[model samples]
Target chain A: MRTLYQFHGGVHPAEHKQESSAHPIVMAPLPTQLIVPLQQHIGQRAKPLVQIGDRVLKGQMIGQADGATSCAVHAPTSGSVSAIEMMPMPHPSSLPDLCISITPDGADEWITRTALDYQNMNPGEVRNRLRDFGLAGLGGAVFPSHVKLNPGKLDKVPTLILNGAECEPWITCDDLLMRERAAEIIAGAKIMQYLLSADAVLIGIEDNKPQAIAAMRAACAATGFEVIAVPTRYPSGGAKQLTKILTGKEPPSGGRSTDIGVQIFNVATAYSVARAVLHGEPMISRIVTVTGNVEQPRNYEVLLGTPVKELVALTGKQRNDTQSYIMGGPMMGFALPTDNVPVIKASNCLIASSPSLFPAPPPALPCIRCTQCAQACPVNLQPQDLYWFSRGREFGKAQEYNLFDCIECGCCDYVCPSHIPLVQYYRFAKSEIWAREREKQQADLARERHEFRLARIEREKKERADKLAAKTQGSKAPAANADIDPKKAAIQAAIERAKLKRSGVTPKNVENLSVETLKEIDEIEARRTQLKQAMEKQSDSPK
Target chain B: MSTALLIMIGLALFLGLVLGYAAIKFKVAESPLVQKIDAILPQTQCGQCGFPGCKPYATAIASGEADINQCPPGGEEGIHKLAELLGVDPKPLNAEHGVPKPKSVAVIDEELCIGCTLCIQACPVDAILGAAKHMHTVIAKECTGCELCIPPCPVDCIQMQVVQEDLTTWKSKYPLHEIRNV
Candidate 1:
C-alpha cells in the first residue's frame, strides 16, 4: 500500500462536480472562424509560420515554437488564414495579443504525420517531437511539456507522479477523461516513465472521483503502476501541494519538483503525449468542462481556437441571470473579460457564471488581526502581513515575508471572515514587484550603455591627439636635420617658391604662345620681382 | 576609606581608556546617510532638482539644505521614499523644480541634423553620439529622458518622445469590482 501524506491547510468547498460528470465527453463542432492566440503557453509566444491568405490543413503548424521554453501552435481544422493581427485574448487583463484568425474550409482535412516509436527513438528525439506537437500541461499552467520532460542535467528521476487530482470545484473534465480513457492515460504514463527512466509511476486521483479511480486502477492493475485516492481538497492539484501529498516531500520554496528528483505531468498532458507519439497527432484540442447555469451541463472535447460563446452554446441555453463567464474552476480561475476570447490550451473549464452559483462577495470589512488567513495558507506564509504590506505598497517588506510563495490560491480569501480579497492584494503585489524588477533591469542596461559611450568618446579623443602629435613630429624632423628652425624653414621654402615664379619657369605650351602674350608675361614677371625686392627691403629696415 | 577611594579612581580611569579605544576602532569614515539618499534619487542628472547631479541633490537632502520633494522624475512615490528614509513628512513635488511627465527618451532627426555637436555637449549622460560636422543621433537606450538635449539643438531636430509600453513593459492595474444590477 502506498502511503499518502497530508499537506498544509485545505478547505472542502462544496464539490459541484456531479452535474458536469454525469454525461460523457462530447466533441464540439468546428466554429466558422478560429482565433488562435500565438501565446497559448507560458513562455515566449510562438512565431507565426503561415501568412494571411495561405491555405492550411487541419493540424498544420501555424505558429512555430520561438525558443527553448515555447511550444508550437497548430490550426485546429483545414482553413484559410484570414487575419493575423492583435486581437483580444483570454486573459484576465483582457489585453490584445497577436492571434491568427482562420476561416475554416469545412473539409477538416489533415496533413501527413508519422509517429515515432518511443522504444526505438532516443529520448531527445521523443522530446523534440512532443515540442513540435505543441504539448503543454493541460492542468491550467500550460507550461511546455518538452522542457519539463528533459530534466536538463539531472542524472536520475526517482519518481514520476501523474496528477489526476482535479480538486477544484465544478471541473470534471479530467475525471471523465480518466474514466473513459484510462488505458490511453496509462500508456502515456508508461511513455513518460520510459523517457525519464523513472523507477516508479504513481497516479493520484481525488477520492471524490470513484469511477475514475476504479477505471484507472483496473487499467494499471498489471502495469506495476499505483493509483491512489487522495482526499478531495481544494487546490491539492497545485503542483507543489500534489507533490507533497503523494511523495511526502515539500519542494523547497522557489524551487522545482525536479530539484528533489521527482517530476509530475497532468494526466491529460500524458494522454496528449501518448496521442502525439502513437497517432502522430498534435495537441490542437482539449477537454473543457462547461457547466453551471445551463440546462445540460457537461464536459466537451474543445478545439484550441474555439471561442467560449460557441462552447457555452453547446451545453444549453444559458440562464438570463448568468452574471459572468469564468474560465477555470471557482477556486483559482479568473473571470474572462468576454465570451469572444478563444479557448487556449490552459483552458480546462468554462462556467456560465450566475448569481446563485457564484454570489457577489460581501463588502470587505477591516482586518481584525484574525489569523484565519494565515492558518488556511497552503504555502505556510503569513497572509495578514503580506496583505498589509501589499496594501501599503511596501513591496520590500512583502518580499521579506515570502510574498511570491503565496501562489494566489484563494484559500486565504476563502477563509477570511472579514471578506478581504486577500488573493487580489497578493496578485497586485506580485505584478507590482515584477514591474519594478523590469524597470530596474532597464535602468541597469541604460547605465552600462551610457558608460560604454563615455569610454568610447574618451578613446576617440586620445586616438586623434596621438595622430596629431605624430604628424607634427614627422614634419619637424626634416627642419631639425636642415639646421633651421621649423617656422624659419617654412618661410624660406615660401620665398624660394616665389623666386621660381619670378624666373618664369613656364610650361612648353605657355612658351609657344604669341609674341604679344609673351611680352605681357615678361612684364608681369618683372613686376613680381620688383615687389619681392621691396618686401625684403622692408623686412631688413624693420627693427 | 582612603583605600576604597584609590580603588574607585583606578577603575574609572581603566573604563574611560577602554571607551576611547572602542570609539576610535569602530568610527565610520563617511556618512552612510548620504549614500542612502543618493540611492533613492533617480539618477537622471537632469538638473531639474536645481542640483548639478543626483549625488549633489542627495548631499543637499542629507544636510537638510534641500527638501525631498524637489525631484520631478521621482514624482510622488519618490518623495514618499525620501520621506520614509529621512523620517520626514511626505510633501507634494515642488512645482518650481518641474512637473512630473511621462517617461520619454530623446530622438534626433538624422536627416535634419547638421552634425553640430551642441546637443552632445548639452547631454548630461552623454547619450548623443556625433562629432563636429557629423550627423548626431541619440542613443535611445542610454537617454535618461531628461529633455536637457532639446534646448541646445541649433536646428530644433531633437524631440522627446514618450516611450510606448508594449506587452513586456505594460502592467495591468488591479481590476475594479463590478456591481451587479440585481
Candidate 2:
C-alpha cells in the first residue's frame, strides 16, 4: 500500500466531474475555419512559417518555435491559410492577438510521418523533437514541455509524479484520457523519467476517479511504477498541491518542483508526449470536457483551434436557460467574452452556465474582518490582508503578505460571505505592478540614450573648436593630419580647395557671355552682397 | 576671580572643538531628496514645464523654484506623488503650462520629409535617426512625444500619434468588478 501525504486546507466542492467522466472520449469534428494562435504556451510566441494563401498539410509545422522557452504550432488538418490577422484569444482578457486562420479543404491529408528512435538519439535531440511536436502542458497551464524536460540544476530527479488528480469539478478530460490511454501515458512517463534520470515514478490519482486509478494501476504494474490514490479535494490537481500530496515535500518559495529534486507532469501531457514520440504526431488536438447545461455532458478529443461554438455544438444543444460560458472549472474558470473565440492550447473545459446552476451573487458587503479566508488558504497566506491591500491599491503591503502565492484558486472567494471579487483585485494589482516595472525599465533606457547623445554632442563640439583654433592660429597644423583616415583627409583637402577657389577665381568665360548670362551674374552678385550684409550685421551685434 | 573665569572659558572652548569635530566626522555629502524627486518625474524632457529637461525641472522643484503641477506629462498622479514625497497638499495641475495628454509617439512622414535635420537637433532624447539631407525615422519606443520635433520640422512632416492600447500593453483596470462572478 502506497502512503499518501496530505497538504494544508482544501475544500471539497461538489464533484460534477462524474457527469462527463462516465462517458467515453469522442473526437470532435473538424470545423470550417481554424484559428491557431502562435502563443499558446507561456513563452515567446511562435514565428509563423507559412503565409496567407499557402497550402498546409495536416501535421505540418505552421509556426516554428521562436526561442528555447517557446513551442512550435502545427496545422490541425489539410487547409489553406485564410488570414493571418488579429482574432479574439482564449484568455480572461479576451483581447485579440495574432492568429493564423485556416480554411480546411476537407481532404484531411497529412505530411510524411516517421517515428524516431529516441533511445539511440541524444536527450537534447529528443527534447528538440518534442518541442517541434508542439508538446506543452495540456493540463491547462500550457507551459512548454521541453523547457520542463531539462533536468536544469538537478543532477538526478528523485521522483517523477504523474498528476491524475483531476480535482477540479466539471473537468473530466484527464480522467477519461487516463482510463482509455493508460499504456500510452505510462510510455510517455518512462520517456520523461529517462530524460530526467529519475530514480522512482509515482502516479497520484484521486480516490473519486476509481476507474482511472484502476486503469493506470494495471498499466503501471508492468513497469513497476507506484500508483497512489489521494483524497478527493479541490486544487489537488495543481502542480504544487499534487507534488505535496505524493512527495510530502514543498517546493521552496518562488522555486520549481525540480528545485527540491522532484517534478510532476499531468497525465494528459504524458499521453500527448507518448503520441508524439511513438507516432510522429504533433499536438494538433486535445481532449476537452464539454459539460454543464448541455444534453450530453461528455469529453471530446477536440482539434486545436476549433471554435468553442462548434465544439459545444457536438455535445448537442445547450439548455435554453444558459446564461454564460466559462473555460476551466467552476473553482477557477473565467467567463468567456464570446463563444466565437477559437480554443487554444490552454483550454481544457468549456462549461455553459445558467441562472439556476450559477445564481448571481448578492451585492458585495463590507469586509467583516472575518478570518474564514485565512483558514481556508491552502498556502497559509492571509487572504483577507491581501484582499484589503489589493483593494486599496497598496501593492507593497500585498507583496509583504506574499500576494503572488495566493494561487487565485478562489478558495477565499468561495468561503467569503461578503461576496467580494477578491481574486480580480489580486489580478489587477499583479498586472499593475508588472506594468510599472516595464515603464521604469523604459525610462532608464531613455535616460541612457539621452545621456549618451549629450556626451557625443559635447565631444564633437570640443573637437570642432580645437580644429578651428588650429586653423586660426596661423595654420601650424600637425603633419599627423596626413595619417588620418582617407575620408577625413579628403574632407580637409576639399575645404582647402574651396578656400583657394573662392580667393583666386577669374572671369575667363565672361567674354563670350550673352545678355541673359550677364543678368544672371548680376542677380548672383546681389544675392552674395545681401548675404555679406547679413553676416556683417551678425558680427557687429554685441555678444 | 580671573582664574575661575579662565577655567570656565577653557571648558567652553574644549566642548565647542569636540562638537565641531563630531559634525565633520558624521557629515553626509548630500541629500538624496533631489534624486527621489527626479525619479518621480516622468522624464519626458519636453521643456513644457519651463525647464530644459526632467533633471532640471527636478532640481528646480527641489529648490522650490518650480511647482509640481507644471509637468503636463506627469499629470495628476504625478502631482499627488510629489505632494506625498514633499508632505504638502496636492494641487491642481497648472493649465498655464499644458494639459495632460495621452502617451504618444512621433511619426515622420518619409515622403514629405525633406531631410532638414532640424527635427533631429530638436529631439532632446535623440530618438530620431538620420544624417544631414537624409530621411529620418523616429524610434517609436524611445520617443516620449515631447512635441519639440514637431515645431522644428521645416516641411511639417512630423506628427504625434497616440499609442494604441493593445493586448501586449494592456493592463487590468484597478478594482474592475462585474456581476460579481467569483
Candidate 3:
C-alpha cells in the first residue's frame, strides 16, 4: 500500500497516559441508577418516548429522534423509569436539563437484538441502521455519524482516514482500546470503509505509541488496510489537520473532508460502528480515561449513563474542594461544573488535578514585543494583530486576519511571556459576532412579519369590500335573488336551527360572511368556544 | 625649501581652523526627553506630582529623582500611561504620597469649616480661594486632589469619595495576551 503524507504545525505536550494505557480496559460494575440526558449529540434533542413508571430493557429505544438532524437514545440497562425531569447537566453554566432517570434491574441482561448485513445493505439501509443504533462520532465533536457517512452528493469517496492520534494530554482510552482490541477497531475501520464505499483506507497513529502502531499494523496485515505512523504532534488528532496529514489534501476552512472524497472517523467510533453493525449491539457504553492527580488513574469501560462522581470515586480521588475538574484535557477541555452529569458519547477523559499541580494563572503583563506567539501559532496568523484588533473591538479587522482559523489550541497562550489569555479574547469576539448576526436575523424576521401582516390586512379589507358590494347588488336586482327562493330558504332555516342546537358554531353568522372568511372565522370561533368550555369543565372538575 | 615650509604651515593652519569651526557650529542638545515629558503632562499647573508644579515633577522624573507611582490625583491609570512612555511596568501607587480617590477635587464643608487660611497656604496649585477670616473654598477646576489641603484643615472637612461606576468607566478585563510586533 502507498504511504500517506504529513502536515505541519503541532506541539508535543507531556502525554501522562502510561497509567491508563498500561492496562486493558475493564468493564465497570453497574451502578444502581443511570441518568441519561436526551440531548447528547450535536444536533436537536431527542424526544422522550417512554414516560415515568414504564419498564425498559437494555438496548431498548427509549427516546426517539426529534428531527432530521438528531439521533435516538437507548436504554443502557434494563430498568424502570423513576422520573423524567430536569437535572444538572455537564455544562460550563451548570444548567439543568430534562433527563431520564432509571432504576437498574441489576441483572445486567440484554434485550432482544438482531444484526443486519451492513456490507450488503444499500446506502439508505446503512444510514437507517446507523440512526437506529444511535451512533455518533465518538471524536469529541459528537456529530451524528450517519450524516457524514451519507454525503449529499453521490460521488464515490476515494479514501477513509482513521484517527488514533490521541494527541491530547492524559487521554489514553483510544490507546488502551487499540492495545487490547486492535482487531475490533480494524474491523470497525472496514465497516466504515464499506459504509463510505471508499477504495482505500488509512489509519494514522502518532509514532509515540509504538505499541498501538504495532498492534494496528498486525491487525492490518490480514485486513489489507494500511496503518501509517505519523510523527507525534499535539493537534495532529484534529480531524482537519489529521486528514491533511494523511492524505496531503487541505479541506477548505469551513468544509468537511467528504468534500474532498475523504471521510475520517475515530478508532473508537469505528469500533462502535462495527459492533453495532455486526454484533447486533447498540452503543450502550464506552471506555473512559480517568487520569490526573488521582491515586489510581485507569481506563474503565463504563456504561453510557454512568455519573462522573462514580468514575472519580473508582479512581480513588477526593472530589470535594478540588482545584478543578476538566472534561477532556487541560488545554482544550471545559471546566465541568458538577460531577453528577453522566458520561455521554462525547466524553473521552476526565482530569481532576489539584490547585498545587495546576495553580491559578498569575496576573498578566503587557507584551514585550517578542515574536514567540506568532512563531507558535499553528494557523500562521499574527497573534499580535489579533490581540490588538480584538482589544479595540475591531472585530472586522480581526476577521480579516484569519482569526477563525485559530483552533484555540492554547499553544500561543502556553508559551506567551506575558501570560495573556489569548484564547478567551478570541472566544469572546467570536461569540459577540454570532450574537450580532442573530440580532440582525431577528430584526429581519420582525420586518418580514410586519410586512406580511400589513399585506394580509389589505387583502382581507379588499375582500370584505367586494363582498359588501356583491351583497348590495344581490339585494337590488331581482335576478340575483331568484336562486334564494322559498324552498331553499326553508332548507337554510332548518340548517340554522340545527346548528344553533349544536355547540360548535351558530349558523346565523355564516350567512352574513363570504364562504372563505366564514369558514376561517367559524374555525377560530369554534376553537375559542371549545377552549372556554374546556376551561369551565376543568374548573368544575375535582382537583 | 621655503615653499615646502610655507605649504606645510598652510595645511596645518587650515586643519586647525576647520576643527575649531565645526566644534563651535554643531552642538546637539543632551537629554532632550525632559521637554517631551513636560509636553505630555496635563499642564493644569495643578502641582499634583509632589514637586512645586508640573515642570518640576517632569524634571525630577527625567532626572530619576522621583518615582513614577507618586501622583495621587493622576491615579494608577495616569501612572500606567506614564510607564508606557517611560518603558517600564506601572508599579502600584505608593501609599505614602496619597491615596487615589474620585475625580472630585475638594469641597469645603462650609458649616464645619473654621474659616481658616491654613488650607490656602497648603494648596500647592493655589487652588483654594479665601482670606484670613473667611471659609476657604476650593476652586474645583484647579484643585488636583493631591490631598495637600486635607491635612492642613483644622476642622477636617475635606473628603475624597470615589466616582461611581458608569458607562465610560466599564472596561473589560484586560486581554490575556497582548502580542506586539518587534
Candidate 4:
C-alpha cells in the first residue's frame, strides 16, 4: 500500500460514530406525507409540472429543472400532490421555498423507469440517462451526477476517488452505506471509472471505520479497484483534502480536481450512479444518519424529501427537555428552529440533544494569541490574521489571507479558549463582501442601461432636430437638411475641395463673384436679348 | 564541620518541600469552560476566525477575552449558541456575521453555481453550497454568519437562510429559555 499523504492541520474531534455504525441501515416506515422541496439540488429552482391536486406516481418527475444547473424532483412515494406552492424548507432561517407536498397513497409504487444496456451504450449515453433521471451528488453536495461523470476531456481523466471518509463526529450514513451496500458501491465506482475513462479507481475510507473499510476492501477484491484506509481526522472527508490525501495532488487554488485531471465522487453518489445505471433507479431515496441524543440513535434508508419531523418521530420523542434540535451533526449542524421544514438533498443527520447531552456553550474571553488554533488548523492558514480582518470587516484583507479557504469545520471554534465564534466573523465578512459585490454588479448593470438610454435619447434628439429643420426649409433644397447641422457648411466645402483635388479642377471661387463681375455678366446677356426681342415685338404689335 | 553541613542541607530540602506544597495548595482551579470554547471551531487551517483554531478561540472565550459574534459562518446561530454557553446575554447576530439571512447555504444549481468555486473562494465558513463547477452545498450548520458566499455565487444561486423545521420539533415559537444543564 502507498503511504497516505497528510494535509497540514486537523483536529482529533471526539468520534460519536460508534453509536450508529454498530447498527445496520434500517428502513423507516412510510409516512402519510412526504414534503419534497422542488428546489432540492443546487441549481435553478425546479419548475412544478404537477398541480396540487394531481396524482403522481412514485419516481415521477413532479418538478422539472428550470435550467441546466437544476435537477428534476421526483415523487418518493406514489401520492397526490397536495400543494405545489412555497412551504418551509429545511434552512437556517426557516424560510419558505417551493415544495411539493405529497399525500402518499401508501402503495410506494414506482413509475416507469428506462434502463440502458451497458453492453451497447457508451459513457455519454449513461450520463444522459442519469441527467434525465435527475441524479445528483448525494453526499450532502446534491450536485448533478451526470455532469460530473462527463468531464470535457475523457482522455485526460485522472483517478476516480471515492470518498467514504465519514469524518464528522456523528455522521455514519456513508459508513452504513459501505457496510450494507459494498457491492453496489464498488459497482458504482466501476461505472464512474468507465464514465470518466479513469486510469484507476481509489476509495478513501477513514481508519476508524474498520467495518466499513473491511467491507469496501472485500467488495473491491474481485474487482481491480483499490480501497485505502486513511487516518481519522475532522473534515478529512472534505473533497479537496481527501483528494490531496489519496492522490498527493492539491487542487489548484479555486480550481477543481477535474481541472487537474481527477474527479472525486462521494461513496453514496457513486453507489447511486451504479444503481441508476444498473437497476434503473431514479435517486428517489438515500441513507440518512438519524442519530444524536435521540431515544434510538440509528441510520435509516430515508426517501428523499421526507420531512424532518417524521424522521425524528420515528426515533421516538425527545426525552421531554431536549434543549436543541440540530439538522446534521453537532459540530457542523444547524440548530433547527422547527420541525415543519422538509428535508432536501443535503439533509444528512437530524440531531436532537437535551441540554444534558449537549451542554450550552461556555462564556468567551479575549484572544491571548495562544496560537493553539494555528496548531490545530489542517490547511496551514493563519486563522488569527483572518479573524482580525474579519472582525474589522476587512473582507478584502480576510480574503487575501485565504478566508475562502476556511472550511468552517468548527475546529477553530471548538479549540478556542476565548469561546469566540471565529467562523461567524469570517462568514460575516465573506457575506458582506459578496453582498457588496452583488450590489456593485447590479449598480454596474443599471449604469450601463442608463448610459445606453442617454445615448439613445441623444441620438433621437439629433435626428428629430434634423427632420424639423428639413421641414421648415424646403425639403427639396440641397441645403435644407444642412440647416440643422452646425458643421454642415464646413463639411460641404471639404467635400468640394476633395472633388476639385481628385479631378484637378478649380474649386468654385465664390469669392471671385464680386459686384462688378455680377453686373457685367447680367448686362451682356440683357443687351443681346433686348435686340432680338425688340425686332420680334415690333412685328407682333403691327400684326 | 560535616555535621553542620548535613544540618544545612536538611534545612534547605525541608524549605523546598514546604514551598512546593504551598504552591500546589495555592493553585486556583482552571475554569472548566476554557477547554470547551476550543472544541467548536471548524479548524480549517484557514485562519479566517481571528484566532488560530478552536482552542485559541476557546481560551479567549473562557478568559472573557472574545465576543461571541465574530464567526461569519456561525452567524446568528453560533452567536446565540456561544452567548447561551457563556451565560452572556444574547445580542442580535452581530452584523459582522454578515446579515443573518435565511439559513440557506450556497447550492450550486449544478447548472448555475458554475463550480468556478468563486462561491467556494467567497465562502468564509467554507459552507458554500458547491464544488469546482460541480454542485456544492453549504453544510448548513458549519456556515458562519459571513455571507462571503454571495460573491462567488456567479449565478446568484447561493441563498442564506435558517434550516427547515417540522411539527414534531417545530414549535410555532421557541419555548422560553429555562437553563437546564441536563
Candidate of highest TM-score: 2
Q: Candidate 4: RMSD over Cα atoms? A: 23.7
- Segments in model 1 whose C-alpha atoms lie over 4 Å from true places: A480-543, B1-39, B51-67, B82-91, B105-143, B152-167, B170-182
- Candidate 4, superposed: residue stretches over 4 Å from native: A475-543, B1-182
- What fraction of native interface contacts is shared by candidate 3? 0.06
List fnat per candidate, in order. 0.19, 0.56, 0.06, 0.00
* Residue A148 local lDDT, model 4: 81
Give lDDT per model, in order. Answer: 0.88, 0.88, 0.78, 0.74
The total of clashing pairs for model 1 equals 1
Model 3, range A2-63, lDDT digits (tens) per residue?
A: 55665555567777778677777888888778988887888888899999999899998888
Q: Pick out the ten consecutive residues of candidate 2 chain B with the lowest summed lDDT.
A: B173-182
TM-scores for all predictions: 0.81, 0.85, 0.67, 0.66
| lDDT per residue as tens, model 2, A1-543 | 766787787888888887887889988887989999998998889999999899999999999999889999999999999999889887777888889999999999999988878888898899999999999998878899988888866667888989898888889998898899999999999999988889899898999989999999899986978999999887788889888888888987778888888888899899889889989999999999999999899999888999998988888766789877899999888889889888888889999998888887777877888888888778888888888898888887888889877788888888888888788788888888887787778777776777788899999999999988967763455555756665677799999999999889985788888999999999999999999999999999999
The residue-level lDDT of candidate 4 at B14 comes to 100
Which 10-residue window in model 1 chain A sums to the lowest lDDT? A442-451
Q: What is the DockQ of each candidate?
A: 0.19, 0.30, 0.03, 0.01
Which ten residues in a row are the worst by lDDT in model 4 chain A?
A: A442-451
- What is the lDDT, from 0 to 100, of the residue A289 in candidate 4? 84
The candidate 2 chain A region of ten consecutive residues with least summed lDDT is A474-483
